[model samples]
Target: MTALVQTVSKSTLLSVVSAIVLGFGIITVAGHVQAATLHDAAHDVRHATGFPCH
Candidate 1:
């Protein structure tokens, strides 16, 4: 029981750490992007994901 708990705790902690790292990376990269470039990227992503941009 204790071993199972420890394993779950470790997995949860790893997931949280990974999410934080990815979020920080996105924020850092986004901060350096120009407004028009970011808008274009978002528009492309929306189209690729089948979201109606118009």
Candidate 2:
């Protein structure tokens, strides 16, 4: 009985950690893509118009 309880606790801790790591990875990747999109748009606008940013 004691062994079973220990195993369950360990499994629960592992599950929680996995969930947190996955969440962080997802958030970071999404933020990166959003930043890249904005950067591309700015670059394109500068080329499209001869007016320089003062």
Candidate 3:
């Protein structure tokens, strides 16, 4: 019997690391931001995009 092993390419590893860093940064910043501020930002974006948040 033979066992198969797989390895990650450099590009794939870099992409995964980048995504993890970006996600962590967004979460950390969001945690420190006030809920009302986030709501206002989202509300304004909704209006700008004509998504009808109201």
TM-score to native of every candidate shown: 0.44, 0.45, 0.48
lDDT-based ranking: 1, 3, 2
| Candidate 2 C-alpha lDDT tens digits along 3-40 | 86566777797887799999988644443334656446
Measured with C-alpha atoms, the lDDT of residue 20 in candidate 2 is 95
Winning candidate number (lDDT): 1
Candidate 3: the clashing residue pairs are none
RMSD of 3: 7.4
Measured with C-alpha atoms, the lDDT of residue 16 in candidate 2 is: 77
TM-score, predicted candidate 3 vs. hidden true structure:
0.48
What C-alpha lDDT, on a 0 to 100 scale, does residue 1 get in candidate 1? 64
The sequence of per-residue lDDT tens digits that candidate 3 reaches over residues 1-54 is 122213766788789889999998875444434467665666655556554343
Top candidate (TM-score):
3
What overall lDDT goes with each candidate model? Answer: 0.66, 0.59, 0.61
Name the regions of candidate 3 deviating beyond 4 angstroms: 1-6, 33-54
RMSD of each: 6.4, 12.2, 7.4
The sequence of per-residue lDDT tens digits that candidate 1 reaches over residues 1-54 is 678657677779789889999998885454434467675767666557664454
